[model samples]
Target: MRGKYTIKEINRIPELLKKGKEYKITYDKDKKYTFIGCGSSYNLGLITTKMLNKNGYKSNVISGGEVIVFDKVPQTDIGIFISRTGESTETVKAVENFKKRKIKTIGITCTADTTLTKVCDETYIFEFANEESVVMTGSFVYILNFLLNGIKKIDIIKDAETVLSKIKEQIDTIDLKKYNHYVFLGYEEEYGISKEGALKIQEMAIQNVEYHEPLEYRHGPKSILNEHTLVVINSKDTKKEAKLAEELKNMEAEVILIGKGKDIDIPYNNGYETPLRMILPQYLGYKKALIEGYDPDQPRNLTKSVILD
Candidate 1:
């Protein structure tokens, strides 16, 4: 039962997504949106904001800590708070700030009867995507796919099982012990996915991880590349990104590209397929944890929710 929850949750993603399609989630085209959350939820907000902005909506993201401590709530017509448990203190408090200003609020969580649902103007709960593990695996992809579907119908759900199988095969062939440092690189929405990828390795495998925009790696970050580093690039299929991957490979770093015609080879369906790309890191992190003798279900010094007093 060490990694039971993580594996179960990851395998449940396709089922959760299929159910998400029938969920009555709503979005407003006329309103500007601000998303607030912490950790995995915050990283999700980043991907959501990028997707919304790219699809002709005005949206931005901020961490719940910023809203509570620095009062960094931006002026926007709508505020969306995301929390897996819906009871994270900073996230609930941030929603309260939005409520005080009379801004329309939305809560996206995997739990229904929680503090977030009680405060927000609207709440969308996907309890099926909820996890028993401290680290988020399926719920992250499920919620992100939910938001992406709200913006535009995501057809990738049909291919999720196939994608997961392929990723697992690729991961099984790689020797996890060979790499000590993990780096994830992407651009825009993919950059957020890369950040989440890095977090997954750090949390579950307890390894050194870094994330940067594909080209940004050249700006001093490349100096640290070595034979023991494994770089996962969430590529945009751009020539520059491809060249960078080649350069890193030549520098003796292992590079796995997750875009058209690359290592993972998932079609970049205008970023709608971004959720599928996440399976790579999720499986990698889980496998790496097993290799390192860490429990992926209960990552060290972490919890299911951050309920600060």
Candidate 2:
């Protein structure tokens, strides 16, 4: 438990975000783009894909294993391979699959001088963001911020301090010991972030967690809400999501809303604001793990990268 890299990395997100702009490139709107990765990288791609498609760009995300096992690689002009350590098996292997199709491949990772750099046509390694922990944290923020920088001009680094401060202010008030179940809700990229947020708590806190679109939760998942449920709505600033937050609170479930100053105020700047939405669950997961006497940095049954046999 002496290893506290999770929170340490979480705290560096704002600084890492500043580094993202240096990597921004002009994203061609008409060219079809494909992103591939696993776990948090996949989720990062999911969010970037959402932002891209929503802004008249053609893009899609695929898990690396889907390319290796199911041959599910889609036609694309370029393939972006994501892996934190530059050694995830499926991701590194899947690069050849894209090359075989004559598609240009780009690699993104935190570490340098690894398999991903050698396999891809080019690689963007942010050695500054290389982590000392098993789980990925700041790298997700850095990489997503980098991709978002290409499509949009809003500097997230300017807003990072206020957004993270609000998240910490609200999360500190939460008695994490009282909760056992966590749920994250949103739509589109918010849903992608919800899924990633769920991952943060899942990997670090080792808790029961769920994620769904805000309205979709009522379709079936709401049946499980109890006093121990802590629901976080990555709000769309919609009337329905606001109403849903109230409904869940009435059910005796603690609720945190991250839109328009409800709990953590982040006015959605189109889809660009989605990356900052992750700070809450990241910090919450860290605090939850500490309360449970578990080490957030050293997650059990996990490693920095998944190298398949």
Q: What is the C-alpha lDDT of each candidate?
A: 0.90, 0.89
Mind giving the per-residue lDDT tens digits that candidate 1 earns over 1-309?
579889888888888888777875556888899999999999999998999998899899999999999877798999999999999999999987887888999999999899999999889988888889899889999888888888987567768988998898888998889999999998899999999999999999999999999999999988889999999999888889889989999999999988887888886777888899888899899999999999999889998998876
Tell how far residue 301 is off in model 2, in angstroms. 0.3
Q: Which regions in candidate 1 have their CA more than 4 angstroms from the true location?
A: none
Model 2: pairs clashing at backbone N, Cα or C within 3 Å: none
**How much is the lDDT of residue 254 in candidate 2?**
98
Poorest stretch of ten by lDDT in candidate 2: 17-26
Measured on C-alpha atoms, candidate 1 has an lDDT of 0.90
The model with the greatest lDDT is 1
Which whole-number lDDT from 0 to 100 does residue 126 have in model 1?
A: 87
- Residue-wise C-alpha lDDT for candidate 2, range 29-53, written one tens digit per residue: 7799999999999998999999999
Off by over 4 Å in 2: 1-3
lDDT at residue 169 of model 1 (Cα atoms): 86
